[model samples]
Target: MSKPAKRKVILGMMAASLALTIGLNPQQADAAVDINASASILVDADSGKILFADNIDDQLPIASMTKMMSEYLILEAIDQGKISWDDEVSISDPVRTLSLQTELSNVPLRQDYSYTVKNLYQSMAIYSANASTIALAEHVAGSEADFVQMMNDKAGELGLESYNFVNSSGLNNSDLAGSHPEGTDANAENELSAKSVAQLAFHLINDYPEVLDTASIPELEFQAGEDETIQMQNWNWMIPGVNAGHEYEGADGLKTGFTSAAGNSFTGTALRDDMRLITVVMGAETRDDRFDETEKLLDYGFDNFHEAELLPEGYKPDGEDVIPVTGGKEKEVSISTSSALRSVIKNDEEELYVPEVSLASELLNEDGEFVAPLEEGQEVGQVQLTYEGEEDVEYLYDNQSSSTPLVADQAVEKASWFTMSMRGIGSFFSGIWTSVSDTVTGWF
Candidate 1:
């Protein structure tokens, strides 16, 4: 894929950051974006850190963005050999009914026609077609209801606590016209927090990057030269110079959603300089506001924050420092961190931070010495990174503020009683000999 147009924009921003280094301090350089969204969040796709958030946990209707889960399941089925891209999907009566509804966004299917999985995926990802999403759901799980259950199950597995999936496509329960699936309530609508949606976007992009292959197409032939041939264009306007008037440089796409119940919402991802950020905007005032707020959120992240490796992998803080064991075959046990520690910090303040390693209290007695029958790979403490000169460490720390575990590098087995007694006797005699030698020296 060609590089996003925002490469130049990001370079310029970096240059500006350098110039600001001469004029503004870190505190002055930090400026927050005020968005009109009812709920919004920006996340580092690589580190899963939240850079900016406003009412991020407030659950709201996500509209067609719910189709992201449907697309995920479809791609999974193909990967598992349960289905193939070329496999044909027969439209059901409900799917045909959805196709005819002028109120809903749909690909307009016919009962006599059969569409391939690839075709349906493209329609759902690019055009946000309601009928195509439901069709794919039914084909994959035998019913839209079962497919929705799968979506909910996946959400739970992902640790998503603030989401409820009522339908494969995000049509409101009322919009479904009492077509709500068997296990769901008649008035149910897919609901999730902006942060939860960002988490979903993170999983979607990382797990099924193949979704972008369909999402990036500005326009395509849905049926190619057939009587019902339809031209589809991506609704996401952030793609630089796409049909959407505002050209957001790195906006590749994820999904866009809107409905009467759920205001304009979007889950968008953009990449610049190998750094990808995901933004979720829910209940924006207008269609354009969703993209505009997303742009602000992305700019705030790219301009103010960065990801850095605080410590290298397999980092040993106290090299050759061993912890003493009370009863062990060995006198001491070795310790080290299992992996590198990564942190996100202000782009301009990366140099003023210091990392601290703290040993476990349980390993120490009153004199603060390690006492152990230590087990290998046992977690004994934590390594934390904090700013050196900053007055407000809390403001700078986030998910990246997390600690790496300090673990035992080697085990120390319990010692035998005879061995312990021999050492005790040797120490007593050595002390008596030292006292005699001191007295003889005094007489001389």
Candidate 2:
């Protein structure tokens, strides 16, 4: 693009501060929820802002959903050069044995043989294969115990509110053939809050979107041409025509879990009409109930919420639109939001949001004056929306922050030496005249 065109595009962004107008037009605190799970939540995938929540903080068993964390660490290992998708991984006896289990296993394993990390990861994500999950975890961290430690540490790092990782596979230790992670009890299983699981799913897709490529696959063969190959089906039926002929529109990925104690759970995400939503269902009574509840959340979100550009480009806060410019040719520089502020909000809640601005302290002095030589679009600080009404608001990621850079709308060049000298002289005389007038007033 040409320079002018680029500038025009850049200038089209507006940093807006959200100031919730309370009582005047209160938003429905619980408009989009009518779920029957022990814990459930719906969030805007991009903003991490909750649209509906119920018992979201209740910690519950996650079952194979526990693989979500292992998925994250495995993906991280690949990203950090610690491992590669094609690297061969060792298969322990316990993994091989568990893969042979009658009820909870998929994609049979042969410990004497070898499998690539990609092969195991695909099986883990698409099939929620217990043995494949353990294999990837072991490959990434050398042991399921150590991998469990990594899972808990990463949960803490991700600001998960309620989480406990006993193993990488999210299976009960009793199912591990007495070979569960070192420190966990024989009956222990992975657990997380609905919010926490949503948080994990949030980072999983945001950090390694490629996981969806496999997670979305309806079915695949673990060993395409090998005799020991097993056909795997993704438990996440939300994927289009993935299972039971049930599908949700825009459904692409996420994770699913089931265990007697954990019941049924799903971390499902979908995208449609430029608005993506993530839903979590925990402790559901039936496998199909989880998907039904997820569909309920997705339907409400898509039907009620929209991506609203609340602040238009060139929008400036009511009283915080200009920055004092010291040493610049102009006394003050006009500023605007660096980008248009958009949020997934319910249709009736737009009037409740207002824009506010804040500046970087280092860039400005106590009197709110910035030094000269600022380029157009030079970022200064940020604008954030604050809600004071009854509804609770939170971002899924712990470190998720308000965006839209507060910037200088126009360039400001330093004043010439001649201009500086003249201004200094004028100030000197003006100060003397003020002092003389004060003295005369006191005498009178």
Candidate 3:
């Protein structure tokens, strides 16, 4: 056979061996999901799995979805001791002015009224109150303008690419005092892609889960038990059983938004059967359409996708390959994965998973064997577990796919020639003695 043909045969046999050893088989993979919204995405909040997405990267006016970041920064302030939930925040003029704007949502902040930071949080999170969000922004960062800078800075820190905040409230009013004033067109609005929104939501829920306690409130009187109280309602109607207009089961607290330029947008989260999903919908035609489309997005995720713990943190991979030492005390050292690997997988597609093992090709000498003077826990290689699909019949969510490091399982020191020669001489002498004893016993 030609050399190329012989190599092909060898490679085919190795692939077959890997499949049988890993219990993988040829099978269909996950199907793509289509959503009705202009831009949308559904992700596993814990694993950051993109179960479904439609134009998720197209930056559009995300309306009140911008509040997710506002809320995140406010919550972060509370966590870092820069502010306290119990601390009273004096309402600022910009916030008071926002209260008078009938076109925007407001919790009716009064400049003279002293409200607890907690009250402001509830109003902003549950009601999507523009005034309360700005009030909290001003109180936390000295001015609303400065607060917008913090929001943008935080977005950069989170590695978000498609977000620009002209205002903390997600309002698209050119009249507002900000650098990126609301434009006559969509570009002027606070913009982000559905994918970026999902990531922001992911950071929000993961870093400060306590914010959910505020977001999930169906209804609360702002400053309840105070002498003067304002009725506040969660604008997110998809709050499970809380909002009668659309009570999605497993739904929880999030924010909603709509503007003449941005249309309707929502960032929602839900949990069912130990799995939490984050959904983002932008530019839905109507108020109800946002909730309806989000419901469909969430349903598609919970139905089609399933979470599977592929490998626990600190899990060692099976059949860890040994690294041969060139000149070491030990001839070889074993290697394994240094971290855990988990994912949200498609149901019934477990058989199609291909765990591709690889080592740093440079670690191999011309003999195609690992040359080692290796230390324990040294990083040597990597193993990536993926599903087969159109990109090879893949079923695994891209974000949640496992890429684990292969580390040295044991230390291998360089072997010395003197030690090798001594061992060989000892073995030869021992064999000679054994043979001499056997012959003497036979003669006797």
Candidate 4:
């Protein structure tokens, strides 16, 4: 990706940092993007590090965005051989009624006809078809109620908190014609925090990258070249060619949603400069506002932050460069980082990273020293990165810091008894000679 014209200016002030000669640091860039929404977040998709966050943990109605969880389960079922893309899913009475309502997002269906799992998935993913989603869910789990349970269980397994899935399609329970999943309030709707939503999207794309192949499609034919076909346009208008006026350079996916309770919301991911960022905005007042707010976030991520080396290969923390080895030919073995530590960092905050060393106790002797016969490239411990900046970073995964291995740089053999005796004798003569020389110099 070509660097935006402003990139030169962003890095122009970094010259002075070069003189530090210790480590590379990012220079502060333009002010952070001001998002207009109830909750929003920006995250590096790879490392899961949160670059920006605003009320990200507040649960709010997410509407159709809830389908991400359903999509995940569907892909997982296919992966596990429990279901296949070519498998036919027969529409049930409730699903057929829902599809025919025309008031909700859907593809019309007849009870006598069946649709392939792949087609229903595409309709749900690209078109946000509510009834298509329900059919797919029922096909996967035998019933919509069971599918909702799977969604919640998968949420728990994915470490998603502040979330609830009442239905597979994300329609308000009332919209389900009182046929909502069991135990849910009639008016209940699926809800999730921007953070949790981003996490779900993160897992979805990573676990099943092929989702993007379908998500990036601007439009598709529900049943192309058939007697009954519905052309569906992706709700995500930011996609290239979908809306030339609103296209973001790298915007590809992931989903857009809206409901009376849940304002316009979007979760989008883009790839540029070898970095993929996920942005979530909820409660936007207008359809354009969600896309506009998403642009600010994507711009902020691309302009103000980048992937940088936190610690270079062979990095050795201060005063922890060597490990003492008892009874070894060498008294100590040199140690250094076994691998490079890299992560997404905000511009102008590069110096805030500090490398910390942690040792593995199992590899230590009674004296807390390395035993004889240390092997080269032997991993003795791990080195991890920690940010010292005032701002706290929230990772999409477990919010854990990045880490690398710490290993011995060279081998250290055990000293033989004969070698130890010879070394002792040599030391005794060396000490005597040094004392004689000191006495002669004093007499002079």
C-alpha TM-scores of all predictions: 0.77, 0.87, 0.77, 0.82
The models' CA-based lDDT, in order, is: 0.80, 0.84, 0.76, 0.88
Candidate 4 stretches greater than 4 Å from native: 1-32, 326-332, 371-378, 397-399, 409-444
Q: Can you rank all candidates by lDDT, best first?
A: 4, 2, 1, 3
Backbone clashes per model, in order? 0, 9, 15, 3
For candidate 3, the lDDT comes to 0.76
lDDT tens digits by residue: candidate 4, 1-444: 458756776676566555453232222233446788999999999889888888888899999999999999999999999999999998888888888877788889877666899989999999999999998999999998999999999999999978999999988999988889888899999999888999999999899999999999998988722488888998898888798767998888999999989999999999998899999999999999999999989998998889988888999878999889877899898889977888888787788988888888887888889887878998999888778976666687774568888998999899999988998999999999999999999999
Per-residue lDDT over 373-441 for candidate 3, one digit per residue giving the tens place of the 0 to 100 score:
778888888888767753233211344445678888888776678987887899899999999999999
lDDT of candidate model 2 versus the reference: 0.84
Q: Per-residue CA lDDT of candidate 1, range 61-119, in tens?
A: 99999998888788888889999999999898888888877568777888767689998
Candidate 3's displacement at residue 147, Å, is 1.8
Q: Residue 53 in candidate 4 has what lDDT?
A: 82
Best model per TM-score: 2
Q: After superposition, how far is residue 331 of candidate 3 from its true place, in Å?
A: 2.6
- Indicate whether candidate 1 or candidate 2 has the larger lDDT: 2
Ranking by TM-score: 2, 4, 1, 3
Model 2 RMSD vs true structure: 11.9
